[model samples]
Target: MDKNNLTPVEKNKSPLILSIVVGIVLILFLAGGLAYAFSTNLITMPFNKAIELLVPEISATANPDSSSIVTITNPNSTGTIYYTIDGSDPLTNSLKYETPITINSTTTLKATVIDEKDNKSDISTQQFTIMEKTVEKAVETVVPENSSSIIIPEEYQGTWHSIKATGTYNFSGNTYTYSSGGNVHSGTIGKIEPYGNSSTILVFYPIEVNHGFTVDPGEKGDGMIKIDGTTYAVENSDVFD
Candidate 1:
């Protein structure tokens, strides 16, 4: 009577033999977890998944055109390229933008991704400019050939520091004011009597200093120089004879 109570019919057969050893250890742990989930295809077992994750697209280039060189392609998923150079939105130190970005003026571009379940994308963008557009050329002033005797444009004769009106000129006497010389401005000059060609005061200052244009001079003189009606000419006097 003291074997305590191991006598309830042997304690109901010891819990029915421990419920058949926990049902055979839960069927060998569900058949060893479905045979390690079908011999390991790397487990996504709920259905099936994986169809193009993403992370691979960037480009740029340059030379005198400032600079830029960002490239990435065919990347399936392995992020580490957050950028923002005016087109904000990319935080994680935000300058992990790799490249040779050397632009001079306007710029705005962005790209971000972190994927791998840590997922953080959605900031991709593109804009560009690196300052290098030079095309300004239309300066062709070349009329030099001054000998000082006054007459000009015989393709112009040398010793030109001459600039009329503003740099103020007096010609012939060596009182050419405009200090800085060379091409148009800072005191540019050229006015061999073109005050709107003012009727030439009706010539004859010795043919207005030797045929200063607009003259017929003689022998039926068809050379012509009409004023009020405006007409000018000079076909002789060897231009400065």
Candidate 2:
């Protein structure tokens, strides 16, 4: 075969060699670029988002029956909760949550949490209403059908007003009369029984007209009758004649 007229096999070999060189160079350039990116943290997109400490959450609620307790909580198990009243922000020096707090009136409560990794959570806040229990009583006329000289407590002799609505109760000599909601109710103290240390229940009876009135058995409490979970304030009338 003449050198000027290269054989088909030789020409093919030359082309294959050139292609291999080009591929190797391209691979080397790509490798260098990858190395540069890693050194400068440019390709660290995935690693930059490593798991981070989470912030804490807060919860709060009020006690419905009494103005004595309000509950506050941090659901995150990895952190401690701090709190403040007076509409102030809580700090590390704030009161640490250990037990339920007592709230007697309207108050602004704020709280914060700090995780184990020192990550601080957003401040949480709540407005708590400690409502005063308004005395509730029914309107009725006092008619003592049953007579017993069971002396009632001196404190029981008084005029009471309904805290929730327009009502009045006048008590004298084991008898109390009430008028409410265009209705009237009257009852005589049949029996006085001790409830708690400072509470007593006065069993009452209706006379004259029944009017389908109901004297709840659960109406026994401290100088007040508990009707429908409400306490009627019974006190000496400011305008007793």
Candidate 3:
């Protein structure tokens, strides 16, 4: 074989060399494609599972005053809280908890936690019982002189019940009875002081049997009477009568 001319054996070796080079190039291309897919997280085979989302924590309380608001919280979980008041499970499209939820009546609350990745947590449920504040008339009592400076309104001279089961308040003449949670607190109206132009404060003192106890009926708001921490609203009156 001449220096410039390849022998038959040498010609065959050239094809082999080219074949090896092509195989190596193909392998490199396949490797690069796999790396790209892995970097982009497009390949599902490498990951066994995704990180699970944390379940939401819920807190709520029933209010006796019928003005109680519920506060739902999710601790250690960073995400939006979805809730439902109808006792159904919470969904992504459910009402979002932007502020504390104000429930005017009895309700069964459900909530769920959703993370930024759209992972949902287990559902949480809670029930709150609200008492119906109904006003009923109690047996009447005679008014005592010098007990109060203001004339007792007939609208207030009745028995009242808190809708939330907070308790009951009976206003008859110069005395009133407030019972709650199996505990009774009775007092006599010492005086009726002016509050706002539309409301008054019913100053009360414990009876002789329970003397030394001071009971202050805070400023009456609207048509509701508040004794201590409990609030009582008059039930519906006889419309026909």
Candidate 4:
């Protein structure tokens, strides 16, 4: 056969073709290794982790009974928040901030946060004041009923002109007689003048036995006033301090 008319059989054994085939195999092996590394998603993290080490945000609330609730919000999405209250930072194992407080008085509410990467956040505090309790007062008192010997606490027997007793009077107790809201009160002192049961139109003897009365501030009728609400027996005479 002429050299110029190369045959297909000669070309099939060419060294150049073999070399190209070897190169392709090596390239494929390298490419596969690169793909495996990407699939595992390993090398891309630490760099990402570095950015996440930043701090987080925290919020807090307090209740009336001296308790508080701490809420930690993690904006990084890639990290979580760990926090503490007890007036301490996240570096300690102190109580985790949760639940509301029953702050009877003024109190301080605090919160802190930390990410999974040990990133520390600033501490936050809130001051709160609790509502105070109200006291009930007794301004006036009712008189006693069915009493013969009427002795009054000298402190109570005062000349009182109250438009309070207008209707039929109803009173209880044997120690004292007084009136409230248009009701006559009879006590150990028998009956109090002016507000006492209708007696012979005459002057009252021993004006000393009459218990006194005081109108409460900002009240129309006699207010619930008494010496701590305990019944005081007619002192047979003048009741001193």
Candidate 5:
């Protein structure tokens, strides 16, 4: 058809339709750009603040002669801090962080904060390097020939159960009786020496050894080490129930 033959409505219709298509295309381009920006963190929504909590901060104070003290802090003070010293991820059921942790050895500590709203923060990790302290070996004092036995400490003069070994030890004064595997062995405490800051080494001298027993008779310098006032290490195994 000839250009001049076309009606005015037809002439206006093409231009109006072209303008509508151009406007729609521009709007779709803008929407696509905005979606990409939001997804890529180029732009963050205001509501995202309510979804994620802030991360916690972990720090440590070093002690050259002893252990390192670790502290965990969060910006939001209303939350409870949970931490792990075994290099594991922190969970709600993990060790609750109340007081500062005393790390005796080198450890990797991880911590997280859980707010009142149950919002958990990202894990914060820190590696603590502890200075190794040389532990002095306990010195043995020669016992007099006339001395049959030494008085056992009052704290250690009781019946104690073994945690790892299948035995029960009863201590009364300087005498000790160990019963295991249907066999009984009696011994006397020869000497007591300080092994460490919180440990004592008790040297034993067996008075009667059961020939049927296959275990140690607590003689020949084999002794028990009291650790932390509650546990005893006998023959390199923890003997505390």
Candidate 6:
């Protein structure tokens, strides 16, 4: 066709068609540029690295008697710590560590940490053994000649009340009677020795009854410490109470 020979409709459609083709080519050129940049490592995209959680730490302090105070700590300080005392593996639903655990006997403590991202850490474990203190018979004085009873020292004798438990302990001669919790436990004072400043260690041999203390008496006797000549505390019990 010759110039200025086209109709009015064709004249208007020419610019619109040319604009659409130009837009398509520009889009293709931009896409090719982006592909080349990525292929040549010119521009980089943002990346997120995986986060790791830290394991917890277990520590313990053994008391003079057969007991220990166990403490658990985490380095992150932002996550929750779960633990177990029965040597089992710890999980999220296990006992949440909030305070120091008091272990009276031998135990294996296990702990782990869980962060906000649900990342779990390796388990930390510690074993605590509460060894019983032994005293020889010849070192202490025995009473009643043939009987297997030890003399109750004058300071620890007589009726005394426990500051911790709602009980009364009566010591007379070589026998002792402990009354508490709607029951009475009578036994012989098997051993007595001097403890820390103004304190004494007393062991009771229960007579067909279990002593109401942390460690139940077996073949061995139940031990108690008289603190400062006023308060009586059992094994694993807090000091001076």
In the range 1-241, model 4's lDDT, one tens digit per residue, is 7766888778666777899999999999988987787678744545554442445555556655544454555555554444443344555454453443343455555554555566555555555556666755533343344435434433334333223322221222224344557565553434333323322121222223544432122222222222222323222313321
- In model 5, the runs with Cα more than 4 Å from the true position are 1-49, 135-241
- List candidate 6 segments past 4 Å from native: 1-50, 134-241
Candidates' RMSD to native = 14.6, 15.2, 17.7, 13.4, 15.7, 16.0
lDDT of 2 at 87: 90
Per residue, candidate 5 scores C-alpha lDDT tens digits across 163-231 of 545667787877778787999977655545443342424434443431211122233232443322333
Lowest summed lDDT across 10 adjacent residues in model 2 is found at 210-219
TM-score of 6: 0.39
Cα RMSD, model 2: 15.2
- TM-score quality measure for candidate 4: 0.33
TM-score (all chains, Cα) for each model: 0.29, 0.33, 0.41, 0.33, 0.36, 0.39
C-alpha local distance difference test of each model: 0.47, 0.63, 0.67, 0.44, 0.68, 0.68
Q: 175-225 in candidate 3: lDDT tens per residue? A: 778788999977666444443232344334433442232223344434555
**Alpha carbon deviation, residue 229, candidate 2 (Å):** 38
Q: Write the per-residue lDDT of candidate 6 for residues 93-190, one digit (tens) a residue.
A: 89999999889987888999987767788999888877866774435443433355446555445665566667767777777777889899676654
Better of 1 and 4 by lDDT: 1
Clashes counted in candidate 1 amount to 7
The order by descending TM-score is 3, 6, 5, 4, 2, 1
Candidate 1: regions farther than 4 A off: 1-8, 11-15, 18-20, 27-93, 96-108, 113-117, 130-140, 144-170, 173-241
Candidate 1's error at 141, in angstroms? Answer: 1.7
Cα displacement (angstroms), candidate 2, residue 19, comes to 35
Alpha-carbon error at 15 in model 6, in Å? 23
lDDT of 2 by residue, 200-230 (tens): 3334443444332223324434445543344
